[model samples]
Target: MRAGVCVILAMGALATMPWAAADCNPPMRPPANQRKFASQAVDSIIASYQPKFKDAQLGQIFANALPNTLDTTVFEHTTSGELAPDTFIITGDITAMWLRDSANQVAPYMRFVSQDSGLFSLISGLVRRQARQVLVDPYANAHQLEGSPPSPHTDDSTSTPAFAGTRVGAMGPTIFERKFEIDTLANFLHLSASFFAAAGKDQPTFGAPVNAAGQTWADAAELVIDTLRTQQASSEEEGGNPPYLFQRTTSQPTDSLQFGRGAPAARTGMIKTGFRPSDDAHTLPFNIPGNAYVVVALREAAAVLSALGRADTAASALALADEVNAGILAFGVVNHPGANGTVLAYEVDGYGNSYFMDDANLPSLLGIPVYGWTNTTDPLYMRTRALLLSKANPYYFSGSVGQGTGGPHDGLDRIWPMSMVARASTALSDQEVLSVLEQLKGSTACTGLMHESINKNSAGSYTRPWFAWANSFFGGLILDLAETRPHLIFA
Candidate 1:
């Protein structure tokens, strides 16, 4: 594609240091022509850019990691035990596919789907598999492939049982982890719409996702509605308290909530998360960012279901979405001295108290605009975003190499590449985005891949060496800049 463009050469160890695992071993093989076409594209998109980005190390970083980071080396066909179409993808450093991770990992590559059918089908399978798992237990955030054993969660928490109001039929392994977070449902819904839109572009016959049972995506939407309503119920509310309890004998100082049943979150109309996206127990049942996310998720559900002619169901979902949105505007936004204005709280009890800081994860205040939950230019979000990136936010870290949000998941003074990506995605200025790119370009510590978190003070010191999500996120940012801020690329 760079056939006519004058290519520049990158200057650094990145240019000279050959990629250790640059190409696929046996090459990707798929029975379908589309899959084979995509296979070659996935395996060679980076190398194809080599001449075009000859002198640009950042470009080299994007080129080298986009495909290699998610190739057959890390993911193989789990059902057939080979590399081919619709194979389940595993997150790096683990064998199970997470509803959240799998979606984000394959997100950046969807741009190539119009050119390759295998990729479209593969992503379609991921969405369907996720929809199937939601039916299994809407509370489960991660799951194992069919016939595979349940992956242990250190067996920390037991979720509030899913109410069988509109439960769908039997199928699949139980679930890898059942600790519920609103983001899990949001992630699945977002992925469904994202895949459907992309795949349907080239394949006119492509239909909306349905679970193992012959249920449509609308049925899945109803499941979300019923489950969310049930989860929000309490002793005073219509459905009585959800009978979920988690008591671990470990010395991990877990959040052993009221014999595992969480404190009644007071029926705020806003959904409560059993755990944060960080996988840590919530200080309070009502999570601010998560509630904001539900508004987005349900709206997505509403839009999709409406298109499918499920009028009543779509209205029901939209009503619930509005309830959550109103809930966020009312209870979630509060004054914070750190931000010097009203901003979204991280977590809150319908009671007065709330945590003002943000986590590095989605539903995070910093990621609000990125998820389409809020406008990045909105005053409150802008103020909240400012505080999140500053020292005022307790988890906000500033070290030698970079500075951004972190979370309990990574410990103190650590910054997640995830947070950096969110920040860049919502950045107000070309300078701001470029600064983030500069911080990330050299933050990998010579792994030539991204890490879950890196030392803010030292670019090399980091954790989670095999985090596939962060690597893909970095690649996504590279793509974003190339599309939206190519001039920034020169600066």
Candidate 2:
């Protein structure tokens, strides 16, 4: 579930270390049989690294986190015939699965899919599950595991004619929360292509029918493309009301969009998003990183569709990606009053309004390179990275304990470990990466697992004690470091 506290104002900043020592003996993981799922390949990974890490604390952290999702959250079912198996993953504190979080939770296991058939089936099954969810409602971000259950958030109107009335399933118990986040859809597409590339499996592996509704991965991809295309219209272009509208009855101002539709956006070619990946409502209609992510996700979708012989759909995906990329370049870049060069705005409206702060979520400006949207050396991304890490970006915080981006999602004076992971993943040098890792070690509050957002001054104070996405992402970072710079861990 999305963390509370959407207040955008950052309070006074202070720099001091939180009193949380790294536990030499971290809590042991749950017993093997008690684990929700297990894999020999993942066991091999932990065994291989445990002896190699020069820092035992980091090693223990890796061991606990790398398998956190499998150990605690995953539920898998295997079938005997042509139908692909089914898997449903809960986003740690929440019983429902978020398309975005579930994908990231299993991402690190991609490499091991071929080595462990169990792991392969789990990931492939998740792909099919996502397709089913997409077919259920492309506008929904979080979804329930089974038949429509009671929803937690206040009822919102999804019945209006918006975005071609594609938000039809928006008002059901099947969807946990119906916030239209573009990255949620994009991540599904990326995961589909990534899964195929890793497993070397196709057709019955993915294209086989998933439900009686005739839902398949290909059908989901088509709907996602169409939804994105429909959202590219400006208010004037659409002629009447915007295509999507979200309203949640809550005291939090950011909980609901103004007048059901979000801030008005001109036709900038970028697809408008109702909310960010954080599940916070957007200050502006167009989310730059979200659009950039769509570009990459679209290209990945194109690859999968092309291989499946859907040339027309594949071509359409590629064309949409190009149009979105062009839109980002033309409208997302801005002259930063506090920076040496122009940088990418975090969010923008087609009609000259923009928000500059970056949230500590995936698809952030600082994570463009990490997201495969751009390279570190790209002048614009480099400039934006500097600005985001400095005082220029309101959400960025520095303290004696750690320094990183936080978002309005968790309010002021907080730093998210996910941002630090993104920083390390995108860093240029071994020292730079190590610095971030050291901060992370101290910010875990001796729990040995990652949290949603920790207090910049006090690591003990944080949100979402059981955030599996951050844990898995942190584990993935360590895997990457071990593979590329062994000395960082081995020394």
Best by the TM-score measure: 2
TM-score of every prediction relative to native = 0.83, 0.94
Q: What is the C-alpha RMSD of each candidate to the true structure, in Å?
A: 7.6, 3.5
- For model 2 the local lDDT of residue 283 reads 94
Q: Which residue runs of candidate 2 sit more than 4 Å off their true CA positions? A: 2-25, 80-83, 160-169, 201-203
Model 1 regions more than 4 Å off = 1-55, 72-87, 154-173, 201-212, 234-243, 254-258
Residue 40 displacement in candidate 2 (angstroms): 0.8
lDDT tens digits, residue span 291-392, model 2: 999999999989989998889999999999999999999999999899898999999998888889999889788888877999998888888998999999
Give the per-residue lDDT digits (tens) of candidate 1, residues 1-491. 00011112232323333333443112222233333123555656655544464336566667545764455223543322222224466666667777777778888887877777666656666666666677777777777766676555546546443567432222225566666777888887877777656666333222443544565445666787888877666435634324444554544443344556555567677888778877667887888888787778788777777777778988988898888788778888898777677888888878777887778866688988877887988998888888877877889988656788888776787788888888899998988887887677656655556677765665445676667777787777777766787677634
In candidate 2, what residue range of length 10 has the lowest lDDT sum? 5-14
Candidate 1: how many backbone clashes?
12
Error of 2 at 6 (Å): 18
Q: How much is the lDDT of residue 375 in candidate 2?
A: 97
